[model samples]
Target chain A: MKRIVQILDSYSYGDGMGNHAGALLNALKARGVDTQIYAKYVDPRLSHMGKNVAEYVPSQEDVILYHLGAGSELNRKVTEYPGRLIINYHNITPPEFFADYNPALEANCRAGYEDVKFLADKVEMAISVSAYNSSELARMGYTCPLHQAPIVMDFSDYTKAPDAATVEKYSDGVSNIVFVGRICPNKKHEDLMLDFYYYTKYFNPNSRLILVGNYRGFEGYYLKLKKYAKKLGLTNVVFTGHIKFSQILAYYHTADLFLCESEHEGFCIPLVEAMHFGVPIVAYDSSAIGETLGTGGVLLREKNPRLTASVMDQILRDESLRKTILEQQKENLKRFDSKAVADRYMEFLLGD
Target chain B: MNYETYAPVLEKAKAALAKKNIPETAVSFCDVRMPAWMGKAFWFVSGVKRKMKRRLGK
Candidate 1:
């Protein structure tokens, strides 16, 4: 059997990209390939699942799959590994996005650009999660065998019934509009507020706009959002900061729509999740989001709160229209299904 | 007046992250909390070894 090892910069328990890597590990093991994960950082409790990058030993016959989304020593090590290297390219957010607020982030992102290019010539083959990301590698002059596959999605969690307490907490009769993302600058929470303001004023006054995400690192931005919401004189707009998984499911079930205004997204897992939960997605047509939704969900090229509200009104009131969008969503979801995506992944990783 | 006119929360996070003592090699976008010197040392050695390997062509 061929041996394959995947390396990443870090692994978080519940993160999208991390989960993608984890799913690959499980899929590879199921295929009977000797596979393991190595990372620069890992949760202590989950140490058995992976090892530190520094501890990894290279093998000439072994294929190493590296997930590249940030700058790290792992880049230098993987570049020098002198073995079969396949890079799972996830686009690095442009450095300019963080220019005003954090120079360190700017520097790190800049490093990611340099590292990706520096290691490009070393890769035997390249796979990106999206065609948009593949195009980026092409622009960087990577002349290797390149293919695109959506990340393997685990839909099991979404299928399970959510926590009763959480479902009860959100069972209020209010119409809910939800967006799940980290409380960060790139997500454009301010725009969410603008849309919510118009959504409530014009379409459904009984509705509540619920923003569900972790507010740990970006408390400053979190505070600004609160101040902005208050400034808008908006009522019933809830920022449910860092809640439990059951709570998240409750939000998804209670939500009538999933709205996003993210300026940049590599794969936008939330868009797919919203589709999975039967929540119709309305998103800005930028980055990989348009590619992700295809023709299933609504894509707005521009953000107009008044017009956005009208569109939401149309979807909510028109049961047929909602059903049509949901049907298309189910069609698009077939692309990201675990079995199909995993088979594609194995094909790329093992194919000659 | 609208989202266009309002200052973004991302900027706030960015500014705050820039102030923290994080090494550039941090894996996460802005929530890096590792000691400064350790991250620096790892990169420093990695860079040196990379150059040496290239020179040796091994």
Candidate 2:
């Protein structure tokens, strides 16, 4: 049997990346390949690097698969190992997108890109999560064989009865708008809040904005956002810090509109989740948002708060347009299910 | 037991050790020159300090 090992800094089964990795591993195993995930950590949060480093040397029979290029320990192993290396490029943000765009972060990300580029050259093959990321690798001069492996979402739960009571509880008799993912600078929660503040003021005063994710890592940015919301008199906004995956769908179902103004993404999994729930999305046309949203959702011009708010207002006010989007979302969402994504990934990994 | 199952568990243990607040000199005293299994652990702990320092903007 062919042996395959996946290397990651962290592996949370509840996370989008973790689910993607887990599904791929299962698919590989189903094809009669002996596959195991070798990571530093295996929880719902944080990267899984430190946990597995002590005993993870590759054997002659193993093909090592590296996920994400952020950790030095993994980098060192890749440099020392002489096995077949296959890297799955998730989200590799250019240094210029960082807070201060500091030279240090730039240099570090550049070094990461160099390591990934080197591994890409030596590896049997490389797979990116989106075409946007593949183009990013190509621009950085990585000439290895590349293919897109979109993230997967299992939407069987959405077909169940709509928990109207649970949805109404979160909705609070107003239009519920939700923004998922980490409350970090890159996710652009602050920009979304600013737009949301204005969106409620002029368009619908009863609408509530919900920001969900961990706040510990981005305290400074999170504080700034809270202060901005206070200054704008948008106290009705809710900040839900880290929710369970099962509860996430309730929020998606309850939400009248979903907004993603992120500056970068490998593949916005939340957008896919929202689409699966038939929620209309108004996202900035950048990175993988355009590719994921396709023609089913509204695309905002730039990341301007006014433009985003304007688009949100338009979506909320029009009932016919909202119904049309929901109908289209139901149709477009089939392309991102886990089985389809897993099949594509298996074909890439096993097909000659 | 196949090496695949044991490899990840061993690596995770090394990574956990690296995150501890132990002194560098004391950490260095640990044997890092065992067979492939133990050698992997030592390399992980020794390199973690360097990795943390770099991420700290040091």
Candidate 3:
């Protein structure tokens, strides 16, 4: 049996990356490949045993699959290991994303760039999560054998709930707009909140906005956002904080409209989830959002909250339009289904 | 120094120092570019002072 070892920095319980890794491992196993996952930290919920590479010895038969993060020491070991190295570049943030254009982030990104260059020069192959990310690798001067295999989501556990509790909780006889993902500056949670507030005020007073996900390395920014919401007198805006995978589906199912204003993304998984639940989306026309949304969701050409509000207003005011978008989304989402993505990934991995 | 090779690191170091509120000139003088003799003398004096303080327990 072919042995594969996948390495990552951290695998939080029920995160997008963790879920994708789990599904990919299962698919590989189904193909009769023996797979083991190694990470600095693994979610306790996952069955795969975690091993700290610094303390553990890797077996000779193992093929190393690495997700190269910012300043990973594992880059050194990849050269030492006598196996095929496949690096999956998730999202390499450009220097502009930082608040003050943090140099540390830039240095780390440069290190990642060098690692990719080294891997491209020496390793077997490299994979990126999106065409945008692949282009980023090219920009970094990596001319390796690159393939675009976007992350896959498993919707088996995301069946629509029977109860209307989520709808009543968020909507309350109003339009409920939901935004999911980490509460960071790049995710633009504050912009979405401001737009939602204006959207509710000028367009639909009964509308409510729900923001989900945890604040990671952006607590001060999140606090500032909360203050901004309060300053705007947004009583209808609700911050659900961090939620579990099951709870996420509940929100997605109940939301009248899903909004994403992320300035960067490798592949927007929540956008796919929203479509799976037949939720119409309004998102910024940037990064992989436009690629993923295609014709299924409305895109804002500019980053103005009033313009975003106007777009949301249009979606809310027109029922037939919303239904049409949702129907198109259902069809558009099939291209990103786990089976199709998995097949493409395997084909790329095995070079078929 | 070639800007392509050294510019990025120097720029990053400058930014890091600025974040800490240390004067760029002072950091460059003390941290990045100090004469070998001056660095050795400073280290030797500091080492001797640390030893004396520890011995005296003061």
Candidate 4:
């Protein structure tokens, strides 16, 4: 029997890439193919998740699926390895996005961009989570066949009720606007606050902006966003640094709107999660976001807080519109169902 | 959550930005002493940047 091997730069708890990798491992195993996950670094918390890359031995029958996102040094070997290669491109933040703020990540991102070009010849098939990223490979001059799929999400965990404590804490009559993603440069944290400012100034004063993501290395940008919000005279803006999934679901449970002002996203998983939780979304159509949304939520070309505020008010006050958005979002959520996506991936993994 | 704390600090940041434009540079670092996982790509990027800089100087 052939083995399905996975490679990633790093794995951590609650990471989107790690989630996809973990889910993919299970999918391959269910098909009775042996699977092994190798990573440059694994979070101590998820020690059993994957082993060090040094321990990974490439066999002729082994198909290695490499998840590319961050600027990790371990990826070069993924191409040099003598086996079938699958390039799973999770779009990297353009290095320019971090040029002004974070030099280290900017360098890493530049390397990631450069690394993809070298894979043009080695990869058997390149799969992008979104078509926008597929087009990028085309532009890079990769001649290999390419495929696209949304991130495989386990909605079972989402359907279960969120933590009641989190739900009750924020359920106190305040309209909560939530964005779940890392506090990174491209997320446009400043822009989210601008929209929040307009939403509160015109629509509802008791509203809150809840950001749920870890801001460990992004402390500078995070602090900058905090100061920018202060400059705008906005309050009720809470950055929940990092919290458990149940708590995240609680924020979603109490959230009135799921809003994204991210300037770049290969595919935003949080938007789908919000839809699963029945929160209506209003997102800026950046890169593959519109395609990811796929008739689920309102897509805006530009960030106009005033107009977005009006849309939120319209969605909230008009029962018909609210119901319509949620209904469409629910209909759209079927595309990302774990079993369905895993089946699609099986075809490629099995070379059927 | 205090909205006021950001105002004065942001003004200072704006003032700093007004002084000079930021430079554009390629990412490059390669040393064996650094974590073994840094791999050859880290130094490869550095080599490419050096060549570009040398060519531009000519």
In the range A1-352, model 1's lDDT, one tens digit per residue, is: 6678889988877878788888888888888889989988986755878888888888887788899998777887787786689999988988887654446777888999999899778899999999888989999999998899998888887877787886777778777889999877788887888877766865579888899998554555666677677766787788887677778888888788999999888889999999898998888877888889886687776766555666676677778878978998888888788988988989988887
TM-score of chain A of each: 0.96, 0.87, 0.90, 0.97
Please give, for residues A85-191, the per-residue lDDT of candidate 4 as tens digits.
Answer: 99899989998888655678899999988888877887899889999999999999888889997788866777777889888889899888899998887888777
- What ranges in model 1 sit over 4 Å off? B1-58
* Model 3 spans with C-alpha error above 4 angstroms: A49-61, A99-114, A160-168, B1-58
* Chain B TM-scores of the candidates: 0.41, 0.33, 0.42, 0.34
Model 3 lDDT per residue over A126-242, tens place:
788888877877776777688888786777767746346654565456788899887766787767876776677666888888897875444445556666776667788878765
What iRMS does model 3 reach? 22.0
Candidate 2 on A1-352: residue-level lDDT in tens? 5577777866765667677677677667667877777667767343332235456766766677678745345764664666667678886666565543234445676667667665655666678888898887787676878888787554554566555666668866788989888776678776777777657765678889988676543444555566667666678788876555556667877888899889888788888888877788877878887777776677654555554565576567768767867776777677777777878876766565
The residue pairs that clash in candidate 3, if any, are none
Would you list the C-alpha lDDT of every candidate in the order shown? Answer: 0.78, 0.67, 0.70, 0.78
Candidate 2: docking tier: incorrect
lDDT of 2 at B38: 39
Instruction: Give the better candidate number (1 or 2) by DockQ.
Output: 1
Winner on lDDT between 3 and 4 is 4
lDDT for residue B34 in candidate 4, whole number 0-100: 29
Interface RMSD to the true structure, each candidate: 16.7, 25.9, 22.0, 16.9
True contacts kept of each: 0.00, 0.00, 0.00, 0.00
